[model samples]
Target: MDIKQLKFLIALDETRHFGQAATRCHITQPTLSMRLRNLEEELGLPLVRRGQRFEGFTAEGERILAWARSLMAAHDGLYAEASACRGQLVGTLRLGLVPLGGFEPMRLLSLFRRQHPNLRFQLFALSSEQILEGLTRNQLDLGLSYLDRLAREQFDSLELADTRMGLLYDQRHFSFTQTSLNWEQLGSLPLGLLSSGMHFRQSIDHAFRSRGLIAQPLLESDSVHNLLQAVSAGLCCAVMPLNGGLEVGNPHLRLLPIAEAHTLAPLGLILRRSAPRSALAEACFEEARRALADELRLSADR
Candidate 1:
């Protein structure tokens, strides 16, 4: 019936127990129960399925919970905007980033922090698919991931980096005179790569297939750092982008460019096409765009 009741519903969903949800809302169990009953009566629909324990929400309850979440999100967004107009930004920005984006997300966050010191951020390392789903579900305000990885989703994206996959290895362990490598040559190396479930790995696999070669990774991990560590320890060579990676400035690991790699894709910032963009989200997006432009400029200079 009211935001208070909606808050109670969210707490109930989270705790899945009447007593615990009531405690979280700082209300008595019976009062919480009464409020829930009133809410169901107002809606003229059976929301909660009551039993010996806190049964899960009924079909209508689930639908109401979805709207509750969205209403709460927009409500928070409005308050944040109001604060921003008063010359302060105070809110938690939920950001989902693919591991491939590396520290770019952090770097972007760092830049935003300089301007809006009061705003906090919650960053999640996710796959491109997960990022897309998170955006649709209103779980994430923004995402840093491959623009092309998402299919059948309405998304607005700003390309953040022109990243390319390359061979990462300690130069001391390899015999490569040239900086760029041919795709066919990768078939002979003991490689450390991402798992097949990851879009990054899928892109690499597709590239190998196009070259009539099968990628046989000696070490497969979902974490980019794991693959990088494998390469660092001279365990195997890794194919990946050097941007925002630990090896970028490391003297020992040489990022051998894949001269004609098809695995490389434009990494970017994405928002749900129809979702409302908060002021903080817009500010961060602009900062990200600036950072990407600087990166591209530096790459050109190099």
Candidate 2:
């Protein structure tokens, strides 16, 4: 019945382990279980399906959990609106970011903080699909993901400039005279690419397939950092974004654009379409717009 009890339930759903959920709520396992029990008694419904360990929620529990998430969102929004009225916005905005190396979310965060110094952020590195699901479930306030992947009807988006892709390699392992290399030219190189299921990897696969080619990666991983590390060790080259934290003066590495890549990856900030928008979400969107404008200005000047 109480918000605290609802929080415990939500935590349990997130962690899927009683002890971990208890730890997240800064309470002991016994207390968390007792509180949840009290909540179930108050509601007169069996919420949890329990045995020796935490199993799962009941059918009724899932319905209640959806309302619980909505209530929690409204509760946070209430506080945020009140703070905004007093000339400052405050609350922890949950942001889900699709994993893309060198995307540099901190740049946007830094800009956001300059205006709303009291506002905080909780960033999660999630896939584009995960981000969409989180937004729909009220588990996330904002998300940075691929614009092309988001449905316009479900969410409002602020699209940024396309992020270009390239081949990353150590200078000692590969030599190239041109500034860019075509996909056909990459066939013979031992490559480290993103794993099959990842969005980035899917894009790479589609591009290769469209050209009547198939990539044979020597190393495949979900983490962009891991792929970069493999390239650093001269174990293999990698396909990466040009802006993905490449060291400018590092003589050992070079990032050459994929010449035949016609469709660059589009990046954007997305917020779920809901009645009475959260003040925190709106503020975050405005800040993102400002940051993009600044970036455009800087690029135009050059």
Candidate 3:
């Protein structure tokens, strides 16, 4: 019925326990219960099923919760836009990113802060699946992930960069006499790969399958940093993206590009189709586009 009621409903849905939900909302349990009861009375439909413990919501309650989330999201967006209209870009911008995408939030944050010094930015490193879920739940304003994996109807995206996959190894463990490796050459090595849930790993799997080859990684990780560490320790060679490649600048590590035509993946920025964009979001988007373009041009020149 009201913003407060909607907030309570969303909190309850997320926590699934009245006590935990009340704690999240910074309210007492009795107050939360009374509010939900009042809401149900007004709607003439029982929302949450009664139980000694936390039970799931009823059918009508589920529908109400869904609408509540959208309403709250729009209301929050309106507040952010109104604040931006006063010549100040001041609001929290929540972003979800795949760990291997090589997005350095600090660099972008530095530039963004110079333009809108009052803006707040929250960054979350998430797997591709988590990023997609966050976008659908209205928990993340934007996501950095593989463009090919996103559903076109539910979201919109802009291609940011081509993430080139390569093999990284400790020179102490293996010598890179060749400039690049074909899929067959890579298949011969004990490699570390991203977890199967990540788009990067999926891309690698597809490349192998298309060539009638099997990729059996010796190690698997969700974090790019961990994979780099493994390569530095001479555990195994790794298949990783160019952005992540920049982090493994150790003298011990050698990076060799994958020469197969299908190894490249495009990294992109995704956002909900109906979510409102704040001035800060617009500035961040423009900066990413510009940075990606510059990087592409430099790569072409080289």
Candidate 4:
């Protein structure tokens, strides 16, 4: 009946343990149990299916939990709006981004912050899969990642651009005639790429396989920065999106476009389709759209 009780229900569902849920809410075990019992009595139905401890929610409890999440999301949105009316939007905007997203998020965050200076941001460099997962759990407000691999039913996305892959290498270690190379050409060269666990690596593998080739890299790293560093030290060449931060400007470093492997991966902003987004989120999403369009235009002019 109350938002506090609804929060308790959501905590229990998220943790799947009574003691932990109570601990999260900073309440005693008996008090948490008694409060839930009181809630059930008021609603005239059992919420949790109990055994010795917390098992799971009943059918009705599951339905209520769904509503609880939606309501909680809306409540947060309302608070943001109220704050906005007072001349500032004060809240944390969490972002989960694939390493390939590069400096685009900073651009978006800067534009948004100019208008709402009080809004704070937290950025996490995550894999494409982790970004989508965080959106579902309400842990992330938005994601800058590859949209091709995400399920259509679960997320709403904006395709920012077709991020063409690039070869970042040091001329001291490997010499190439052309400024741009092909996928088949990469198989023959010493390479360091993202680990296979990342979706970006999977996309690279798929591109190689489609051309009757296999990915044989000299080094594998989960962090994009590490892979780029390996290439910088003349250890190997790295294959990644032609975005900012990856191509270190140096006489020895070369940022070459990958040819025939014209497999263009879509990079975008993704958010949960079912959840109620905050006002700050809505405004930032619009800013992201504009920023992407401007970037595309600049790329075209180049």
Candidate 5:
């Protein structure tokens, strides 16, 4: 069948409503209905069960929808490859990043644009759940997130950095001179924590539980930067990833490593398993790999 007809079927399957599907496909309801009717006529079977409302697709329609998604993905891949061959890498590269992953996409973007100046990049700061959903829908080209609790089969992962948990406190308030402190010591102090939705926060909570302690945060925030700001203001201390974007110049802030024997978390790049790489994607990937290697070597030297 025609590619447009296949697209219509896929949209219908996703939305399960004629008007909503037509809107998604950027067509009028009548046009979508006509296309579906013509497709069914060509196949000599009713593709959808009609009733008072848009009920559901027939068995053949369900099968067609599956094949349609695969076909559309392949078609898009071919277009991307052809565009790359023309020396014009011109398409939107969508990326989702966790807020605290220490990924400097700005650096990657600068490098990518120098090579593929025509490419467009769309970056979203999203939760892990949204990143996975965007990848499944073929909306995102790459994701940067924590590796904990990730579903391995759905995406290919490349470890980019080791993120260590640490206590961020105002040195003046605590009079702590050492570089790190034990978990038990932290438990004795009032603290601020990340809100429950963030994966980093959950990891911190898990670390506390493993030590037979409870995390009772006097203040909680969804924003990592805000949490750091609070600590700088001496509102309370917070446990955060060492690689979180706080700089050393933030006079009131000090990063103290968590004393739990091992507290490093893996931060990485994730891409759909079936996604074909574009010139821009490959360039960004290579830069990330190089940066990760440098980080590892620095840690070894230390």
Candidate 6:
């Protein structure tokens, strides 16, 4: 019935354990249970399914939990808006970033921090699917991911950069003395690639399939550093995005753009579209626009 009760419910849902949820809410387990019971009594519906331990929520509870998240989001947005009027934006901005190991997300966050010092940030390195899921669930305020996968009607976006796929390898390992490399050329090399479930990896697979080739990766990992390390050690070549957190000065490694890599898309920021947008989300979006404007302009000039 009250915000505290809703908070307790959400906490329980997140932790999936009564004791842990109580600890998160800074309340005793008994008190938390009493409040939730009172809430159930007021609503005349059973929210939680009872057992020896926390089993799960009822169907009704799932619906109510969604509303609870929306209510909390709106409440936080209102508070942020009020604080901004007083010349300081204060609140935690949760950001979901694709685990691309790129500098673009960090650069944007750094610029945002300088502009709004009072604001706090919680960053999560997630997959594109996870980022989208978090945004939909109201668990993330913003996400930095590939713009092509996001539904335009479901979310608003800002393109940060035009991403390009490339080949990463040690110059000493192979005889690939070319300005660019294509998927067909990469078919014979022992390669390191991201896990198959990842969007980045899926893109790589698609590119290879289009050329009637299949990549036989010697190493498969979710970590970009692992792939880079493999290339650095001359263990295998890698195919990855050129702008996805690649370090250009590595003496052992070289990144060459993939020839005719038209499938790679723009990487950018996304916010879930909702009525009465979060003040923090809007501020961050506008700030990103301003921060990237100069760079975009210079690129245009060149």
Whole-model lDDT, model 6: 0.84
Candidate 5 weakest lDDT stretch, 10 residues: 274-283
- List clash counts for every candidate, in order: 0, 0, 0, 0, 0, 1
Q: Which ten residues in a row are the worst by lDDT in model 6?
A: 97-106
C-alpha lDDT of candidate 2 relative to the true structure: 0.85
TM-score of each: 0.76, 0.92, 0.77, 0.72, 0.66, 0.84
Candidate 4: RMSD to truth: 4.9
Among these predictions, the greatest lDDT belongs to 2
Q: Which ten residues in a row have the lowest lDDT in candidate 3?
A: 240-249
Candidate 3 structure, TM-score to reference: 0.77
Q: Which regions of candidate 2 deviate over 4 angstroms?
A: 246-251, 262-265, 294-302
Instruction: Please give, for residues 1-302, the per-residue lDDT of candidate 4 as tens digits.
Output: 78888888888987899999999999987888888998899988899999998989999987777777778878888999898788778888878988765335677788888877888998898988888877886767888888777898988788865666788888788877887888878888888988886767877888898899999999999887788779878888888777655555567787888875433367888877775877767767877777778888998999
Which clashing pairs does model 1 show?
A: none
Each prediction's RMSD over C-alphas, in Å, is: 4.6, 2.2, 3.8, 4.9, 5.6, 3.1
| Predicted candidate 6 versus true structure: per-residue lDDT over 1-302, tens digit per residue | 78999999999998999999999999999999999999999999999997989999999999988888889989998999999999888999999887553336778878889999988899887888899988998988999887778899999998876666778878888666789987788887899989988767877888888888887899999887788888888899888777765756677677788887633566789999976468898899889888788888998999
Expressed as tens digits, the lDDT of each residue in 1-302 for candidate 3 is 67999999988987899999999999999999999999999999899987997799999998888788778777877777777788777788888888666444566678778877887888898877798888887768888887777799988787766777777788888897888898998888989998886777888898998899998999998877788888888888987665564534476776678886333467778877765544456666777777768988999999
CA lDDT scores, all candidates in order:
0.81, 0.85, 0.79, 0.80, 0.76, 0.84
Q: Compute the lDDT of residue 29 as modeled in candidate 1.
A: 97
Candidate 6 accuracy as TM-score: 0.84
Clashing residue pairs in candidate 4 (N, C-alpha, C atoms within 3 angstroms): none
The C-alpha stretches of model 5 lying farther than 4 A from their native spots are 1-79, 102-107, 110-114, 171-174, 261-265, 275-279, 290-302
